[model samples]
Target: MDTRSLVQYELFGLWLLKRMALRFRCFAKDERCRGSSVIGLVCSWIETDLEGYRFGDNLIVGSMLDDLAPDTEDHQSRYTSSALDAVNAASIMLDFLKTRDVSLIKEIADLARDSVDMLAQEMISDDLTEAALENAIENHPLMVEELSLQEYLWSLAGEVAGSGDFFGDLIRANAEVEARLMK
Candidate 1:
């Protein structure tokens, strides 16, 4: 699959996890509020760490978009597609939250989980970025075979740093995810 496709998959997975984390922190973790005590450490991870990954993605892509010449708009467009996809996903979350429909959030998580599962089946290519994305999905927060949606939210949010520098953001997210996995 192309890098953009992989990014989309990752974003969807990330979105679901983020949504879950936000929900768990607000509702799922509190039994008195009808939440489960089983929400656990994963909730902490999401709140403390994994949130704002998409903002990091936007920072990198926005920087890239700014660097391109007006004539190279098409090239810039290719790079921006994934970022746009991420924005759309976030809007979906915002819409859900505006109504405060907790149960509906499950649908997003399910979609995110499904996206991760679909991505795990994708074949990796010689491209380094694609390889990195694939590796990211196959491991850490994702662990596609049996993805823990809750943990994924925290891991990605904590790990993903939406920086203005592209490579810098990638490096940061990788290092953060690596450290989180080690624990």
Candidate 2:
């Protein structure tokens, strides 16, 4: 995949992680809520994640499509199939995450953060400017998965520097859901 597409996937994944974390925080604060409706929302979010993954995987597969010789139909098909499998896996993961409890959400968030860190390291080899590094470090709470849910989401998307608006939207959505559940 091209650098731009990779960046887009990374951004989308980050957004998804942020949203999932926010949802878990809201769920943790309320115990009275239960049953299928809430579960359904989570499931839908997972589906969205799967869709994002499909787009990512397709981009990866497309990169190899041009490398194969004109007659190499089998290889091309195999990559195409593999891309589909990745999408399916993403979908299943989404479904599983939706059904799981807050604890599982925490685990997933940790995994996602690790993945993001690894991806960043792989993608950005050059030393970041001092200011950039400082910004990342300062905003580490939101970007780091290990922090408390409230702190991470709030710091990541809350009025902190370098935070994307996506984080703020996630926080707002989470609050709205919680408010609905409380009523």
Candidate 3:
């Protein structure tokens, strides 16, 4: 898979997991809500090969088995580590969401923003000023149409800094789904 597709997959997986976490929260509290349904949905989702479905407009061409299976079997081999990371993040986020009374979500979002900023700053380096970076990028053209790597990283940092509202996003998505179901 291409870098863009891989990113989309990771993002889509995160979004799906957040949606699932919300549903799981409902199941945990509401007696009427069937937890089995959620479990079954998760099972089906994970079991389905990457190529079995369409992610946005792009169609994945290979099975996730390609990722899960290692070329050489060893006691410690990295297979599906990326997917597992997403799953782990989702699980931890769900734990935070469960503590609705606390400010864990906000803290987590802030920490994420800070982490991204730090990483971006490290990638950008202090030696080059913003203007210098821009001048360099303008002078040197990449084959790709998009911004240079430094510019892209800087843009991402700016975006993360501007919108570090994880709790709001989750709430808004849930509210929209509820509103749609009512209709």
lDDT string, candidate 1, 1-183, tens digits: 443333333433444544333433332223222222222222232233323432222333333323321232343232222222223334334433234344444555555454444434443443558668666666744444336644554345433433345356655665554454444
Model 1 regions lying over 4 Å from their true place:
1-85, 124-146, 149-183
* Per-residue lDDT of 112 in model 2: 47
RMSD, every candidate, angstroms? 18.1, 17.8, 17.8
Task: List the candidate numbers ranked by TM-score, top first.
Answer: 1, 2, 3
- Candidate 2 Cα deviation (angstroms), residue 161: 26
CA lDDT, every model vs. true structure: 0.40, 0.38, 0.34
Error of 2 at 68 (Å): 22
Query: Comparing 1 and 3 by TM-score, which wins?
Result: 1
Q: How close is candidate 3 to the true structure, as a TM-score?
A: 0.24
lDDT of 2 by residue, 76-125 (tens): 23223222222322333343433433333344444545434433444443
Clashes of each: 7, 0, 0
- Give TM-scores for every candidate, taking all chains together and pairing residue i with residue i: 0.30, 0.27, 0.24
Residue pairs that clash (backbone atoms under 3 angstroms), model 3: none
